[model samples]
Target: MTYHRITSIDDRYFKPFHQLLQTIFPPEEVLEYELWREPIQDPAIYVYAALDGEEVVGATEYRYYKELRVAMTDFTIIGKASMGIGRFLMRNREQHLEQIMKDSGTVSLGMFAEIYDPYRAGIHSFGGVSPMNPIVRREVLSHMGYKRLELTYVHPSWDHEGAAVSELDLCFLPQNEELSELPALLIVSFLTGYYEALPNKPEAWHAMIEQLKTKETVKLAPL
Candidate 1:
């Protein structure tokens, strides 16, 4: 398996990356190909893909907040399970972010992800309901040291005008005390046994967390 950062949509891995997304999300939930391609071009966005001999099996995208020093996982999809591709892509993204911090003389307080609530199903246009399947993705994330922070918020739906029914869970790793004041259920993982649960913890995992702690604390915008 090979893992690399995607800098451009034309970077040879674009087609498979696009296909992987199409295969995962429903038609209405997926963005138009052109529209989706735009974010990958933005320098602030980081896209990583996992390939098994040239076939893109998994892809993860993140948006970096320079001022906040936070990297948010915007979306991640894995075409196959139990291959360990998801974990590979996540660790790669974290390493990439760490390098960015080192180059900029900043520190990343934590990595975060917002996922649709797996328990709920959305109403479909054909009168049938479409269930949200975030279980597999959530499991992979939890194993990677990300704890589910009790920050639940309703994300307004784009498909249904003026309706905000999508509930999302906000999760983060190496929790900070400052985050607890933000009116969210903050869960932190004690690195001890958690790493043992992972298939293989990245060599830099512990060092990276220590480096992150030395940086300035993340300031939360008033809620």
Candidate 2:
């Protein structure tokens, strides 16, 4: 199996990969297929897949904010680790992002991910026989060295008509081991731009950003 980066929406595996995400995640968690089309051409956005003989088995997506020098791990779906593809794709993705930084002569502060709060998120069946347990997912990510940020995180609405999603935790994998804390303003800035780029946002989005403004620092804790 090989890892493939989808730089164009025309890639044959692009649609299939989106279909796979729809199968595994609920509507709120997965972006619409058409939404993937525009970002595919943006240098800041990245989408990749693990393929076995042209058949996509797993995929990951992320974005880099050049000004912030940070990357966000938006979505990833790698099945059971027993298959080893999960680890492979993850390591490759990190390396790819590092390469991007190197080519640009810039260094990333860290990579961020938003994970469901296991206790609060409950179980998501996604029409599958086996439901997804956030607890298990958290454990898996914890083993990979992702540390949860200590903050009241509420996901902004994905679109104008959507409501804010709660029970989510922001996780970070820092570029430097000695780095332990980040200024609250960094997160506030990133989130402000994040929401503004969306089609529309609700009051909760504004409230969350306002709350972040009152914090001096955002600390990280073991997941």
Candidate 3:
């Protein structure tokens, strides 16, 4: 399999990569094609594809907030399961993000991702098909060293049209082992940068940050 950092929306693999996301993720979670095109044009956003010959087997997307010294994993999907494709893609993406931080003369804090809470939202399905079981998904992520943050996570709607997603868990993986507990300020900074970049701010945005401010640190638990 060949790994590629897809830089342009016009790339032949872009459409297929996005199609994979549509097939796996629910419509509410997947951004509109044009909306994605805008972010892909930005320097902070990174999109990658894992291909077997000409077919896209896996894909991942991320956004690096330079000022906050942190990044967010926006989307990741493996078209062919249990082939180690997801691990390979994530490994490559992390290395790339690290390089970006190094080149900018800054240290990375951590990476965060919003995952569905199986207990609250049962199994996530699209068109009657469950692409990845939520329970098993957490196990896979746990194996990769990601931990669930001990806080109520509400996924903000960037478009302002969709309702805020509360049935999700915010998982995090720090840059190094020395960074044990997640600082509340870091989470606040990351969220601030995240919401600022988007056009529409979720109504709960301010309250969420305030909620984090009340705590000294956010505890991380095994996924």
Candidate 4:
């Protein structure tokens, strides 16, 4: 199998990625995004796509957040893919990251991931799914312990054809609640499965990021 990693959404192959996401979600619901990246000695985020021929058969996204520096995370996947690819990429990147955290005495893989099974109805993967990512599902927030978290929802507005073209900032605050991290919400939203959004559903994802944060408290020495 041939695997491709995307650092910039503007890459020629990224067109396929956009097509996949746009096809899955209505124009309004889907995010019109750009893949802007900066050069880093050790890359933190990677979007992997595998192709049998020239078509994208499987894909997954991963990241290494500042807070959870030790462990690398891969959660979101599109098309027919599995945990193995995700795990492979993460494990490969973890070697360097884990060592850094160990030297700093902040061991224990600090991966922020919710279990998922991709074969399920929607957005489920690996083990399970995160219910209603920040902007993905709004009504299900309070039930899952997530506060309104300030202005975080973007309402997708459709064009005359109703095919969905652009999005407008819709202030969706459940109630008076404190805001979480500032800029990290977008990055955190990725880990929360915000990309797999569907309209008019109870919950595309049954799982939600609740009690856990770090991949591990202390990194155990490699055997």
- Least well predicted 10-residue stretch by lDDT in candidate 2: 125-134
Error of 4 at 75 (Å): 3.8
The TM-score of candidate 4 is: 0.39
lDDT of each: 0.57, 0.77, 0.77, 0.38
> What TM-score does each of the candidates earn?
0.66, 0.89, 0.88, 0.39
Candidates 2 and 4 compared: the better one by TM-score is 2
lDDT of 4: 0.38
What would the C-alpha RMSD of candidate 3 be, to one decimal place?
Answer: 2.4
Worst 10 residues of 1 by lDDT: 123-132
- Candidate 2, residue 132: how far the Cα is off, in Å: 6.3
**Candidate 1, 1-223: lDDT as tens digits:** 7876787767888877877776776554444566546656778777778889888888787765555666677677767766876667767876788888888788776766665555664432211111124654556565656655533333333232323434456566544634532222111232222222233333344444454345443334211
TM-score of model 2 vs. true structure: 0.89
State residue 123's C-alpha deviation in candidate 2, in Å: 0.9
* CA lDDT, candidate 4, residue 85: 40
Off by over 4 Å in 4: 25-30, 35-42, 70-74, 81-108, 114-223
Q: Candidate order by TM-score, highest to lowest?
A: 2, 3, 1, 4
- Residue 137 Cα positional deviation in candidate 1, in Å, after optimal superposition: 2.7
RMSD of each: 12.6, 2.3, 2.4, 13.1
lDDT of 2 at 186: 93
